[model samples]
Structures are given as C-alpha cells and as structure tokens.
Target: MLINKAHQALTDDVVKENFLKYGNPDGPSDVKHGIALPKFLIDGPSSPFLVVIYILMIAVILPIFVNSWWDGVKSYTKLGLHVDTTTYFLEYLLNYNPAELITIEKIIGFLSHAKEFKLYKRSLTPEIVQKLLLSHINRTQLSPSEEQLKLQVVAIAPKLIIGFLDLAATFRNNEVCFQLVETHRCLIQALNPEANATVNKYKEILQLPGASLEKLDTTQPIYTLGKLLKKPTIDPSKFLNIENTKEVLDVAAQIPLIEPLDCKFTVPGESYVPPASTSHVDLRFIVKSPAQKSKPDVSKLSKEVIETQLKDPETLDYLRNPLKVVEDQPKMPLYSVPPYFPDVDYVRQHSGWVAFLILQKDGGKLADVPNYITRVDLSNLKLSPAEFLESKAIVSAYKFPLSTPTPNVGTYHFRFVLRHLLYFGSDLDIPFVMNIENKPVETKRDLYEIEDPDEDSIAGAFAQMRGESVKKFEHEYESSDDEDADDDEEEEESDWSDIDTDTEDESDEKK
Candidate 1:
C-alpha cells in the first residue's frame, strides 16, 4: 500500500502543479490554518450538534446584530441630530407664541436644549445650561464658570442652526428654514457682549464695523445699514475714530444692496397667462455697492454703455438663461469676517442672498421654496469711490418656476423676500401682483358663405331634407292666401251686378 500511494502522489497532475507553484506535494498547505476538530465533533454522531449551532446563529446572533443596526438608525435624524434633540426643538417652537417678541435672550435660552452641549465633556448638563441661560435672560449675575458656559452655548447655537438649516432645506421646509436663518443672525448679534442696549434693540446697524449705539441712536433714527449709508454727507469720522474711519469706509463700501428693477409673474415668450397655464416668477435686479453713501444711479451710466451691456443680445441671453454665468468677483476679505464667534470655520460668512416668495393672502406664508443668489459680481467694490458709484450696474436675474398651474382667472398678491445671509438690514421685501387672464373667445364664420336660404333654392331643399324650415317662407305663404281670398270676393260682386241688369231688360220687353 505505501508503494502504491507513493506512485500515485508522484504521478498526479494536482500534486505536480502544487510542487511547481508552492514546492509542496500534498497540495500546498494553507499559510494560516484553523485548529483541527476533535474526532467526535467531526464524526457522523455530531450532525445534530452542528444543526443546533447553525440554529443558534440564525435565530439569536443574527437578530441581535440586526436590532443593533436598527436602533442606531432610529437614534439620529436626517439632519444628523439626535432624535431627542429634534423633538426638544420642535416642542419648544410649537408652543412659542408669534405675537411675543423674539429677543436674543429668549432665543439663546431656547438653544440650550441642544444635545451637543453634553458633548463638551465638562460638568455642564442640559439642565445646568438651561438654568444659566435663564439667569442670563433675567439679567442676573453669573459666576465665571456659568459665564463661560453661557458664551460657549451661545457660540454653539448658530452652528447648530446651520445644521438645522441643512435639514430644513433637505425637506424643502421653507418657512422653518427662513426662521432658522433669522435665528442664526440673532445669535450672531448676541455674541457681542459690549454692545449697548440700543445696539441690541437695533442689531442691523452692527453690520458696519465702527457703528455703535452712541453714534447710531442719535437724533436721526438710523437703525438699518441702508439708512446709515444713505444718510446725506455720511461722515464716518463722526461715528468712528479718525484712525479707524478709512477701514470702516472700505468695509462699508463692499456691502451689497439689491435694487429691484422689475418683478413680474408671467409665462415666458407669451404676453399673458391663460387660465390653468404654467407660469414662473421673473425677478430682475441690480447689485449696487453703496460706496458713496447712496444707491447706485443707473442714469449715471452713459447711454452707450447701457445699450451695450444691458440691451445687447448676448447680455439679454445671459440674463434670460436659467443657468447664469457671469465674471467672478473677488472673494470677501478676511478682515471683514465677524470676530465674535469662537471659530471662524464654524461661522464662515457667505456672500449670498436667499430669495423667498410669500403669499400675502395666506398671512404671508411662503409660496415657494427659497433660492440662493451667489453669482453676483462684486468687482465694483474694487473700484475707486467715484468710479464705483458711476460704474455699470451688476444686473442679476432669478426665475422661480411655479409647480402648479393658475387655475383661477384673478390677481394674486405675493411678496418677494431677499434675505442676506450675513447682514441683517440688507434684506429686501418687494410686493407684486400676478394677473391670470381668461382665454380668448373664438369668432367662427360660416364655412360655405351661403346667403339666407331662399325657399325655392337648393339650400332650402337641403334644409327640408334635414327636417328644418325657414321662418321667412312661412310668412310669405300666409300673405299669398290673404290676397287670393280678396280677389275672389270682388269677382262674386261683379257677377251679381250683371244678373240684375239682364233681369231689368227682360221686364221692359214684356211691357
């Protein structure tokens, strides 16, 4: 038997291949091998034991793994927030009364419920954070630790809102998203602890670098950035120190203000929208840099420049195309970034505006999801003060497609909200009307131009064939019968007169 096995191993093709590749004859041993099984476990009597092992894996172990994965999925929201965190926000916002004013303290206290605060790994808990925020809101003094916690939570609030904005946008929840954006701006304003009460009340003026409550709360009520810029003979030196005035002016010059040129809701390439027709909102506006303390005047632009830039076919095509491509402008300077936030990366400023269409009749409810305007050209900010004011305007257009048709023929009142992401007072609200017209009535002419059918004509013959009659023929038949009756009466009278004359002649002859 040993001699036969040796011959078979030497002659086998598999053994030869293994010897050539791995230099082994017993068909190459695995590099890593499991322990050998016991004789009883590998025997026929172990079949039942093997079946039990498989049942345990399938029924218990597999289900345990599946349940763990499912639990993980249920724990987080689509916004990557903990389920409890989302529930906390929703419940708080639901009970919130709209009539009540939204103050910085109220919003900060509300934001303390976020679960991310626990991740700080400090002694701070959600309840402790809430109590500290409440004390801050009530104007109570806090210890150093409590103060640090308050600032940290306030800093985290805006970052948390940025995440919630993404979640709201993912679901296309416009109203909630807009409210979140406004809340973000409020939180940013709250970061400045040195701002006075007046500054807190009118937070919009804070967008300017050197503006403060003392300079802004003067006789003239300049609460907004636009108002501050538009103030006649705006002297930065009056508000800012002489050394800092130039820096403030340069920063102010870069702030953008949108001036609406035309806003209309209509069907493209058509004069009017018929009932149940598809339509879209067309918004035309110019992005003007308020460098000269006033709105950019389009009239300042020469006639030739307007005709070439605004009225040219290529420029018109660029404006009308849904995908607008314009020359890029210099990015926002680093010095312009807000300094109160803990980390610039978390609260990086974006140069864009979110456009929202709201229906006035529905209590100013959102009519469509928001759109972003990020392609605006800010090259004018780089120009000298004089050239910047008189330069050609940076015209941008946005088209919002309505999902549903206007089934009714009437006027609709809508408000366009142009909300700036970084600035508070730079937002614009424009109210416009959309008119849906009725379809035109068609005037149909006779196909054959047949005259009023005569009773004796082929047209009349066809009418009779179709079991129809003309009113004119009926009136003519009645008139002919009346004439015949009158003629017969006259003839009868003449015959009677002749008979009377003949009888008289006979009587005379007899006499």
Candidate 2:
C-alpha cells in the first residue's frame, strides 16, 4: 500500500526538485517546466523516513565505525551518489538524528500536495523502455546487477511496448498519448534497478534516437498536465491544484496502469548468474610482511618478522579449512572485484598487509577478525611493536557451502591477490584487493592499422621473446594455404555425394 501511495506521490513539486538537484537542479531559473514526477520521488521530501535518513546521514552516520555497508561517504562523496536511497537507509541505522528543521507534516504535505511525479515503469511498451535505457546508458552508475537488468528489460521491452499499444487506443489526442507511449522505454529503464545503465543508455540514445515518452497514446487529457508535471522546476502551489490534479489522477488511473517490473532475469547491479547457488569455498591468500625483515633470505624468515602469527581461533580455523585448488586452465571467467579501497591513496607507500578471508557455509561469522585490533601498525607503516597485527573483525561476506565435495582445495579460481592496506593515518581497516585472475586476456589487441615500422618493431620483439625463426611466418602461411586448398577439394568431393541418383550411382561405382 505504501509503495502504491508512494507511487501516487510522484508530483510536479518533487519532479522539479529532482531534475534540479539530480539532472541539473542549478540550471537556468527560467525553463521551469518539464516532467515533475522524478523530482517528487527525489527532492519533494515525501519520504519522511528517507528525508530523516538524509539529514541523519549528514549528521550522525559520518561518525559511525562501520566502513563498508553503503561504502563510506568518502569515495561516494566524489561520485555524488549519496543523493539516492541506499545510503539514506544506512544513515538511519548508524546515526539517529533527533532534531529536525523540517517538520514531518511539512515533508509529507510537500509530497502529498506536489503534482504527480512520473515513474517510467515497464509498461507493455518495452521498445520505448529500451530506447530510453540505451539513451541514458552513458550517465547512470548501475551496479553489476543493474547491467543484467538492462539486458533483461531490453529483451522484455517488446512485450511492454505492445501493452502500451493497447492503451494507445483509448486517447483522443493520439499524438500526445502516442508521444508519451514512445518514451515508455526510457521511463521503464529509469525505473530499472540498473540506474547507472539507464542513465548512460539514456545519454547514448538522447544523442540519436531522441525518443521520449511524449510520443505515446493515452486515455486522458493527462498529457497537457503531464507537460506541466514534467517541468524541471515549479512552485508547490502550481502543482497543488487539487481539482485539476485529481482530474489528471483519474485519467491516469483509467489508463492501463504501469507497475514496477521486477527483474526476474537477475538482481539489478552485479550479474551473479551462479550455477545453482551451489556453495563453494572462496579463499584469498595475502602474504603478510613482517614487522622487520633483516634481508632477502630465501632459506629463513628475517628476525624482525613477528613469528607469532595471530593464533586466534578465527585465524587458525581459516587456515585449517581445507582449500581445494581448482584446476587452472587458459580460459578465465569474468569476475567482478568490489571497490575495496578508494583510489585516492598514495599506493606505492601503502603497506603490504593482506588478508586471507574465508567465507564459511551457512552464513554466520563469515569474517573471523574482531572489529578493532591493536593492529594499527599492521595497517599503517608505523610499528612500535605494540600496534602489531591483531585479530580485528571482518565485515560480512558471502558464505560458502557447509561441506564441499572436493578435496583439500587451494585457490583454483584466482592466480594471485595483490593487495595493499590503506592507512588513513592510524586506520588499518581498508584494504585494496586486486587480482590477476589467471593471465592477461588480450595478447594481440591492437595489431591492425599499426605502421609497418611499428609493426616490424613489435614483430621483432615477438621474435626475440619467442625465439622463433623469421621464416616460420612464411612456412605457416604456405602451410595454411595448402590446408585450405585441400579442404576445398574435400568439400567438393562431399558435395558430389549429396547429389541425387547420379551421385548415388557414382558412390556405388566408387565403392
């Protein structure tokens, strides 16, 4: 019910605010008209919980000890994504902000009175959705789940487009209704959980397709009001017209309703198409640098090395768990690496403290470490012997199956993990995890269009690297041509056999 109510609350006031803040909130003051639906969802301040969440976000959560729930505000602040709902929820839990400048009444009223904001849901018109999504693809920051969602919606768009075609039959001003119908794709994509893809795809299409929902057919005169609601900015009073707004609402209701489309293809963000949700152990090994290394001695560890490893139960259990090493092959599956570390650090100076995280089956206590260890030295370069690496806690991670079928497994998926801990003065928690999956994917990517001399230089490097004779190239070329001609002759023979009775007689005679 709240979702429906919330859906109803997409009004002009909110729509105006959304575009102003999100799309271009600070643009020229004169062009105060466009779609008001998005703004209502964003800036109209309707979500009491969400707004309180936002204020609390600015107030309390900044001081919380957690680092990676919604991802810290530090890096996100750069990306400017905190304006959305994910971070807003996290703020509510960490920092309970009590004092409110804006009363709940005012907030809810703003949303209630705000003219209906548009939600480009996946209606029957999927083509409209695809055009919109592709158009905005360049601007949105969709998670891995989101990319899959984009593809799914694209595949499903045709079905949705046909749905709108049925709705298009009801309106008198077919142009206005049809125009809006045409843009069903963009609106549905905007509703997509893959916000980033929607935005980016939208930008792409805006350059070319230039299609919008303004083309669809509709059952009501809501198009004229839709124009008013689409404004980038509008006065609250302008949309607060209860009589006209209700009339528009009636019309919107009469038309074929558009509801939020759940992506069955996969979750929006990272496309984790697991084989069977079958549990498998994932082990990451980190080589710990000693507090002190005397010199490079392959035979023995340095005296400065803290021989006493973290003998904590969690740590011991992790190493004790038998790791089954998968057979390494030439082909590597595409894996996504979470942004474990912010890119704003002096990486060279970072310490070589790594973590070998183990995710157990059944999902509890995935991270064995404690919240805080005197391991500040383990995180930072400064080691006073007291701030040694301790048993600090790890955040929750995807757990593995309780019992694996395979034997003592080591890492088969990952070749190696090159990670460095990020030390913000005394903070040693943030770790950067970069992996060389198996080997480089592209060996000869930019071979074509290279100048002859450059090509020769590359060829020479290849020759020196592989120690191959220069004539090897010619031999392979000639051999390949001979093979092709022979293959052609063989194909001709096969073709003769496929012919009718004459061919059958020839085959019988040959036999």
Task: Name model 2 segments beyond 4 Å from true.
Answer: 1-124, 140-403, 408-511
lDDT at 76, model 2: 36
Worst 10 residues of 2 by lDDT: 256-265
What shift in Å separates residue 124 of candidate 2 from its native position after superposition?
A: 6.3
Q: Write one digit per residue (lDDT tens) for candidate 1, span 398-438.
A: 66777777769888898888887666666889999988888
Clashing residue pairs in all predictions, respectively, total: 0, 92
Q: If candidate 2 were superposed on the true structure by all CA atoms, what would the RMSD be?
A: 35.3
lDDT of 2 by residue, 1-511 (tens): 6555344445456645655566632333554654324556666557666667777876778756465554555433332222232243223323423254322222122222211111223342434433435533323445676554554443333233233322332222222222223233233223221333332333221211222323322222222322323331343123333334444333222211011111111111212323222233232211122221122222232333322221112344343442212121111111111111122122222222222222232321112221111112112122222332232211111112323222222332211111122111111222222221222244464858443332245675676577653432233344677787997999898777667668788889999
lDDT score, candidate 2: 0.30
At residue 51, give the lDDT of candidate 1: 65
